[model samples]
Target: MRKTAIIVGELKSRYSVGRALQQNERTGYI
Candidate 1:
């Protein structure tokens, strides 16, 4: 149960980072 929770948290964090990066690229950051 604890492991599953950790994995979910990590996945969410990574997803948010990816989304932010995509947005930045759209705005000409990348």
Candidate 2:
């Protein structure tokens, strides 16, 4: 359970980062 929680947290964080990067690219922020 602990490992799963960690993995899920990492995945969510990574997904949010990817989304932010994409948004930035679209808005010409990067």
Candidate 3:
């Protein structure tokens, strides 16, 4: 159960990071 929780947290963080990067790229390009 602990391992699953850790994995979920990592995935959520990664997803948020990816989304932020995408937003940054859009602003930078424009």
Candidate 4:
């Protein structure tokens, strides 16, 4: 259970980062 939670957390963080990067690209921030 703990391992599953950790994996999920990691995935969520990575997804959020990817989304933020996309937004930045759209706005020419990166």
Candidate 5:
């Protein structure tokens, strides 16, 4: 259970970072 929680947290952080990067790129290009 603890390992699963850690994995979930890592995934959430990674997703947020990826989304932010994508938005930044779009804003810069457009």
Candidate 6:
């Protein structure tokens, strides 16, 4: 269970970083 939680957390953190980068690109385009 603990390992599963860690894996999920890592995936979420990576997703958030990618999302933030996309948003930054959008802002720059605007």
Most TM-score-accurate candidate: 2
Question: What lDDT tens digits, residue by residue, belong to model 5 across residues 1-30?
Answer: 999999999999999999999998989953
Top lDDT model: 2
lDDT of model 6 at position 20? 91
> Model 1: per-residue lDDT, tens digit, 1-30?
999999999999999999999999999987
Q: Model 6 over residues 1-30: C-alpha lDDT tens digits?
A: 999999999999999999999999989953
For residues 8-29, what per-residue lDDT tens digits would candidate 3 score against the true structure? 9999999999999999898996
- The clash number for model 5 is 0
Residue lDDT tens for model 4, 1-30:
999999999999999999999999999998
TM-score of each: 0.92, 0.95, 0.88, 0.93, 0.90, 0.82
Q: Weakest 10 consecutive residues, lDDT, candidate 3?
A: 21-30
Clashes of 3: 0
- Badly placed stretches (over 4 Å) of model 4 are none
Q: List the pairs of residues colliding in candidate 4.
A: none
For each of the candidates, the C-alpha root-mean-square deviation to the true structure, in angstroms, is: 0.8, 0.4, 2.3, 0.4, 2.5, 2.5
Report, for every candidate in turn, its global Cα lDDT versus the true structure. Answer: 0.98, 0.99, 0.94, 0.98, 0.94, 0.94
| Model 6 per-residue lDDT at 25 | 96
For model 2, the stretches where C-alpha displacement exceeds 4 angstroms are none
Scored by lDDT, model 1 comes in at 0.98
10 residues in a row with least lDDT, candidate 6:
21-30
